[model samples]
Target: MPDSPRLHRAKAGRFVTFQFMPSLNQLLAAHAPLLVLDAASTRIQVGWLAPGSAHWAASFAEAGIGLFECLDQLQTRPEAAGAFVFCDGPGSILGVRTVAMMLRAWLVLRSRPVFAYHSLLLLAHARRDPALTVIADARRDSWHCAAIGAPLRRVPTAELPVRLAMPEGFRTWSTAPADLERIPYSLAELLPATHDADIFRAIDEPDAFLHEEPSYATWSPQIHRAP
Candidate 1:
């Protein structure tokens, strides 16, 4: 019998890097090479970049798990290294943090390399050129959103500032606490199609922040809770 071909064996020295940057374009442009674990609600998308080629991974996270919680495949596969996680945020603040904790623990249990990303930016990367507004629709609190355009304006949780800035003909949608779907599209529009330049960035779980971020990044829009 012939030896079966495997990715781990096929490509050695390939490290799975977890890049938690605020901007996808920055990440992708910076890293000349890598693979990406672009996970989100109900789906985990993967993509790879080799020498001169760029392709997306058709394989994604399991069906039943929450966004960014897909680790089953990484655990089973004998890849060069463990998987990396780029978490998004803005709505599920605590849930986003919990997922990080979960990823770290999972990595420790499986001996994998884990990384982080500003969860909110994932959507920002997906939809670019919209007035990026993060609707902070928490169960118990009022709603809030922020504009990412020039002269960045942080919308008041109690009142969406666009209402006042918009011309008479321009329309702005209101995000109620119960309305989750309405806002995702709005959020997606702001994200520019992008990712880290080098998909693989070696990183360890963080216990606390040690220094100021060199770039302008906001940890926003967490949609779920860590349970």
Candidate 2:
């Protein structure tokens, strides 16, 4: 699939991109029997979204083991699903990457459309609170911030709002801001409210979300001389 052109903005020493996604209802309508995976937090959530009803399974173990556990509980094979949905980031990088790697391997066996969504964006859409500022630790004294109607950005911790909502089970390195709200990050809890919310986007390749594409500078060989 061709890459979709996305709008990007530079903020807090990173380039952020605005992603648009379709809702749960929309996904079910078009692609029933969908297999959804979310390992963006401490919990590993797996769901089988079919017409009329959906089944959710979860595990709290480490990503590598927990993912398979949840999948086993669901008991649905990859080929049986019409399409696949995955949470792309703003949470556990290793967990997110684990899910992405599994999805890529599954794609090798059988090709299907895969969709991606940001963890904070999903929570924002589910909560439907205009004043709710969703945040996740971005390390280096910065955080990933998302609101109902704004693009996601990396903001310095000192600049964060007095009150903020963080998804449950997100790991934070710095001191949490005052008046921080911990919201449910489970798919079973969050997905119910997002039935009509547009928060999923189709992705050709699956990978953990990065604020900017990594770049490396070329080095040339030269004779060294001491001054």
Candidate 3:
């Protein structure tokens, strides 16, 4: 596989090196059949997505069993050695960290492009709404909330308004099934389309997010707890 830079500059009439940036089209064309590992929930889900594919193949294991173990087992299959997208999240810290660590290792050893997307981005893509709000349990007393096509933040569950109303005309999507008023979309249906560039742009830039190690987001003490 070619690791050529996206843009090269001529230094003294010689083309110097530059960094490589892959687009969604290139990724799909060069490495069709993308694998997705979503550990953003209590259940660690793994799925396969390809452009224009008619179906999405997926399954999950309990996070308590250890996501790394499940991923290791899944990796034994022939399809595991390829480009992948991982759900970098505000869910189970252990699960997300495990996958993130593995991806960084793969980047150094295999040089495969491992893209990360926020968990809410997946929900937003599934809802297919122009403006949307996604609220997921952040564990403890907070909620992992995001205004899709906008920004993300952690809000306290106690401060939730007395009435859960959509902001203006925006649609509200929540994983809380009891909130029957909120619209819920099938995650499986969106997995295939989730590999596009729009989602990739949400990944934190390498220079800003990665330094001593490859982290998916800006360093937050709350997000990155010392081990």
Candidate 4:
């Protein structure tokens, strides 16, 4: 990206590989890269963390943030050597185009490698024997859902029903979106601010399916009883 600090690639650079079916863990040896955002129909989440720090810096707002912002903000704000972004799909013809433009923009703005992965796949990547069904309500009287078993297939959010609930076999894990609402970082504090900030905000998307939130961060085996 444009504001990047120059550094040569690590000669011994390698990525940690983990098996997703049963659990997810990175190789302790892998350096942490800045994880940009999870733009979804329900909520927009942003975060970054220092490699191996185990601590997280995060924020949350409305969904569709990707459709508006230049995306270089993710690179510029945190100033990471590399960036990874996860987004729901298959978006409109315009959404797909946005992804393409954003990737190129990040490359130029950050002067580093920028990668885009399907948000569902990234989420599913952490699941062992992951069965992901991209569901979203089309409104009207009809809705759509696409169930997938990863390593088996990839599903897009637009094609799925927005309000559709997940199956029983799956577990949930998300940094509380509400927690992000509490950290009041102003737009002026965003380093390089944007005038067209509406896209990254929330939307009135599909909400046709039925699902429940499973306990993620707050639950513990010792203190919480399983239903």
Candidate 5:
């Protein structure tokens, strides 16, 4: 199949490239016995979708131990998974990175295909509301926003529109807007509704989503000079 369109976002005064995410339906059609991990919120969610199965076997737990607990519940070994799916975040950085680290280690043991989706994008597609804007905290009073048929972007909290939705369990540093909708983040609830939905993209390396690749200036020693 031909690849999807590339997405880009401005980071560090330059736009960074993003791979096109395929829809859940497309993923199901392409791979079987897929293992999915989502740790973008306070609760960690794991899902198992095997060949010819209509429903996903799901589990949820608190962040620190959730991934392992879900795997244990599904009785899945790394080798048993045909391919892996993960939610790369605009949410919990530590939790998302932890899952990414584990996926990297497993890939080293046995090479397999890996795919990823943005947390806000997934929620946006699931909600299927053109007018509703989905957001996650981006710190420093900014928020990551995703609307139907639009690329993800970071907007100032003050600039957010009236129809705003935040997924359950996301942490926020800024005060939430009035009449904000708390959308469900439970995979157990989402998968059944969106199993056939087209909204995932392929990824080679698993890691947390960064609007831009981090850049640092080299430090040099110099004698102090008075202005």
Candidate 6:
């Protein structure tokens, strides 16, 4: 396939043994490096974080690419085997599943740990806004809704709840462009900013990391829940 216009990479760096996974406590306790992958968008993103920062280093983003392609490039990173963080989602089902499955395989084959971040939580963190609402297309005339620091909720478009919805003066972010214009939300792609690598930097609780299989939300009746 022809390379997409958005394909990019920053200056690379040496890999470290420190990683985050299985638990945030282990991450902090081990002071390991972190790898974050966001494959739920039209464009895929790969980034890394140092031991104690929320900033990214040598992060890369590209459109018209698949998860394997992103992993192909990531394989060059010295930290490829480190603990990984993923954006488990309510976005593209295939995209998220492929990435998650590949990472799961890596966990078995390489013994690397895996952690998950809610798609909404990632968007809120990227926006650096504590009060914004996250909206992802849920099909069926409904949408998946999540506020910063809150759990996920499904809401109908026509009957949007005023209180649970984006509050006045608060920004609304989404991964789908159509959702941006159709739902009137802002674009907050999952690519990490230069200053932060690990999205889980500030989290200290061990339970913050996932131990079971990651899951993505869907509206299709035929599709079984992700495991």
Indicate the worst ten consecutive residues by lDDT in candidate 5. Answer: 8-17
Residue 69, candidate 5: how far off, in angstroms? 1.0
| Per-residue accuracy of model 3 over 55-154 as CA lDDT, tens digit each | 3333355443444555455554323545666766645566677667656665566544466666665666556665455666655665656554665666
The whole-model lDDT of each prediction reads: 0.37, 0.84, 0.51, 0.32, 0.78, 0.48
What ranking of all candidate models by lDDT puts the best one first?
Answer: 2, 5, 3, 6, 1, 4
In Å, residue 207's CA in model 2 sits off its true spot by 0.7
TM-score of 5: 0.83
Identify the superior model by lDDT, candidate 4 or candidate 6. 6
The RMSD (Cα, Å) of candidate 1 is 13.1
State the TM-score for model 3.
Answer: 0.58
Each candidate structure's TM-score, on Cα atoms with residue i matched to residue i, is 0.44, 0.87, 0.58, 0.39, 0.83, 0.54
Q: List the residue pairs that clash in candidate 5.
A: 21-200, 21-201, 22-200, 22-201, 23-198, 23-199, 23-200, 24-199
For residues 46-144, could you state the per-residue lDDT of candidate 5 as single tens digits?
A: 888765563333335655578888777777776787678898898999989988999999999987778888888778877878899999888888899
Residue 78 error, candidate 6, Å: 8.5
For 1-227, candidate 6 gives per-residue lDDT tens digits of 13333222211432223333223434433334566666555556665455445433221243224544554655545245356766666565555676666666665655554566656555554556555566666666666776656666776776554433221112234333232422211222343231243434322221222323579887756857899
lDDT of 4 by residue, 36-71 (tens): 443332333454534333222323322335433423
- The window of 10 residues in a row where model 2 has the poorest summed lDDT is 8-17
RMSD of each: 13.1, 8.4, 10.0, 19.2, 7.7, 13.1
TM-score of model 2 vs. true structure: 0.87
- Among these predictions, the greatest lDDT belongs to 2
